[model samples]
Target: MVNIFDNKEYLSFFCFIFFSLFFCVFMLFLSSLLGGKSLSRYKHTPFESGIAPVGDTHLHFSVKFYLVAMFFVIFDMEALYLYVWSVSIVETGWTGFIEAFIFILFLLLSLFYLVRIKALNWTHK
Candidate 1:
């Protein structure tokens, strides 16, 4: 059995890490020493596109747009998971295929519900 604790290579690796960390901390300290700040009301105020901010940040958004975005994200994630499972289908055999099929069926059912609720309709007028 080899004694890993007795290895010179491991000691040298740790020494390198320690020196790197020390150098990083020293540089940060030097930078902070060079930089100075002055606080003011204008500095604290929120900046927006080089123009003064007007309206409230907590403004209401369209529910339909959010719903459509959520639907897209859910379906996109499902496709990504399906792709990962497809690569290992041979190893997983019929069980994986059945599981993936059921997953797709559930997603389709959800999509059907969304369609019924007019969630996909972009024209609100």
Candidate 2:
């Protein structure tokens, strides 16, 4: 069997990995050794703009918020794709335009479906 250490590339790769791990560990060790230690009461508490935190940190969120967020992300990504296609319109010609039209058609259909299902409605129905 050929020794992996005999190959220059394999040896170099192993050396690089070893050095990377050593550097990370050494940096962490140095930081801990040189870092200051604080045992103040507020050390473990959540702080905001030098103000003490009040009330519960974990508040219940409405599912509508997440639904709207997902819709925004999906539409925003579609917009990005359209922007990219528009930038390369000259290269893609009519074919790109047709494809984009079809994509937009599907987007509109999906939006309509969501509206029909009252997905965007904030009212609890």
Candidate 3:
């Protein structure tokens, strides 16, 4: 086996990483020491249009909107998987092709079911 420890490239890479980490830590410590001495009392309060905050930060959301968002996210994640399969199509060959087809078919079937069952219907509308 070739001696990896004797390589000049590996030694240079190690030195570069060591210096980068050391510089980062030194800067962070220096900033923490020098930059935190002048904090005002009003700097931490929440400001809203130069007025005091009003009632009820919590607002009601329609379930239909959440349902539509969930469906979009599921389909979006499926598209990402399809993208990965496309990127490595030659490596995965026919087995991957068949599997991806089945996956898409099932996703379509689920979408149809969601539509048929009115899962995506506007409840508030």
Candidate 4:
């Protein structure tokens, strides 16, 4: 039996951790200190294709645009999951097949519901 309180390995581990933390802190502060403190007026402004800043930086976007983007991401992730399931279907056998089938059906139903609610109708929104 070994006494946990008198471990030399633990002391070495603690020293390693402290050294790592000190190195990270030293590098971060050194990089910040080396950076330029001054900034030009033009540099602060947003450069839109080098045409200069036009109008206000803040612009209101349509809710429909955001909704469609979110749905696209959700669907893309669903497809990715389906692809992973397909790859594992051989190893998982019948149970995995049934589960993935149900999952695909659920996603299809969700897509149908979104379509019914006109979530993808960009022209009308």
Q: Can you list the residue pairs that collide in candidate 3? A: none
RMSD of 3: 5.1
TM-score, model 3 to reference: 0.61
Compose the digit string of candidate 2's lDDT tens values, residues 1-125. Answer: 99988899998999999999999999999999999999988788876899877778898999899999999999998989999999999999999999999999999999999999999998866
- Taking the tens digit of each residue's C-alpha lDDT, what string does model 1 give over 61-121? 7898788788889999998989989999999899999999999999999989988987788
Clashing pairs in 1: none
Q: Please give the CA lDDT of all the candidate structures.
A: 0.89, 0.94, 0.91, 0.87
- As for TM-score, the candidate ahead, 1 or 4, is 4
Q: Candidate 4 on 1-39: residue-level lDDT in tens? A: 988769999999999999999999999999899977877
- Model 1 accuracy (lDDT, Cα): 0.89
| Best model number under lDDT | 2
Best by TM-score: 2
Candidate 3 per-residue lDDT over residues 1-125, each given as its tens digit: 89998899999999999999999999999999888676899887779889977887788987777888888999999989999999999999999999999999999999999989989776543
Error of 2 at 36 (Å): 3.0
| Candidate 4 off by > 4 Å | 1-27, 39-43, 47-51, 123-125
